[model samples]
Target: MVGDYDSYFADRARRGAETSPTSATTEPAKTAPAKPRNAPKSGLTYKETRELETLEKTIAETERKIADIETLFSDPEFYRTRAAEAAPLQKELESLKTGLDDAYARWGELEDKKSGS
Candidate 1:
């Protein structure tokens, strides 16, 4: 699980670097041939970039909420005392899992498009 999360973040960092302006070093920055104003280095259109950002936000938030719920479920005392509450939380966890799956699928599609796969 940690590997999955780490890979996601590493991929995000790589994509972010691709989209950002080139950093200047001690030497003068060499200018590359200019691309069209609308063309980003990542090869995603502006709309697709926006969609990716939104999807990333949703995925991160959903993962966080799922982790919180999982932590709650892991506590035996909480479960023993609040078995009734567990059913609603279980439903919520399933719902969140579904949404996370969808978000990941969409993310993969966008990534594939970006990679020209």
Candidate 2:
């Protein structure tokens, strides 16, 4: 399957190159991206930054969703709207709470390491 996919994309690329006028040029192709350095050289600085940012964004989004559900619950008319409607929200709330807890724990661990160093 992997080879098939590679070949499929390769075929498409060939087709595209044939269709493009620039394909006739003798100019060299663009260079590939630089190889990533080892963690010690970078000490996970870039990865940790990205991870914390993504986690914070996800946590904020989850909190917003939980707040939205809470707002729905506050509506006297929405009360007992149906178990089917509220059950999914309850499930999502539980999942988000767990994820937020995990993210905070990881963030704390990263901060501790950063400070200890």
Candidate 3:
């Protein structure tokens, strides 16, 4: 009886091995189609676009001021004569940066709302 059972299992195993592909060389199964790459039809409204543009311009101006301050601080003569002059510009730049950050956060919130997130 044990021998008969062993032969029965061996036959079942052989059948299973034959039905399944043994080699990894077989082509992979087909995948689902990819999602479209285009952005959704929805986008920023005209007012939001204008606000973003304004914020971007202000940020650019602030960046220019920071660059000028850095250059002035690097020059020994300017540091001695005009370090005080750069202080207010530096403070204004910091305030602009904070405003820029707030504007960006607001933009993100608006985008999420528009996207129905």
Best-matching candidate per TM-score: 1
**1 against 2, candidate with superior lDDT:** 1
lDDT of 2 by residue, 1-117 (tens): 356888999988988988788756658788999998765532348788788778778878878987888888677777556546777877877887888789789877766666655
- Candidate 1 lDDT over 1-117, as tens digits, reads 356888989988998897666553346768998876875466678899899999999999999999999999999999789989999999999999999999999999898888877
TM-score of every candidate: 0.60, 0.55, 0.46
* Candidate 1 accuracy as TM-score: 0.60
lDDT of each model, Cα atoms only?
0.90, 0.76, 0.74
Better of 1 and 2 by TM-score: 1
**Strongest candidate by lDDT:** 1
lDDT of 1 at 102: 98
lDDT of 1: 0.90
Ranking by lDDT: 1, 2, 3
Off by over 4 Å in 3: 1-42, 110-117
| Clash count list over all predictions | 0, 0, 0
Model 2 C-alpha RMSD to native? 19.8
* Count of clashes in candidate 1: 0
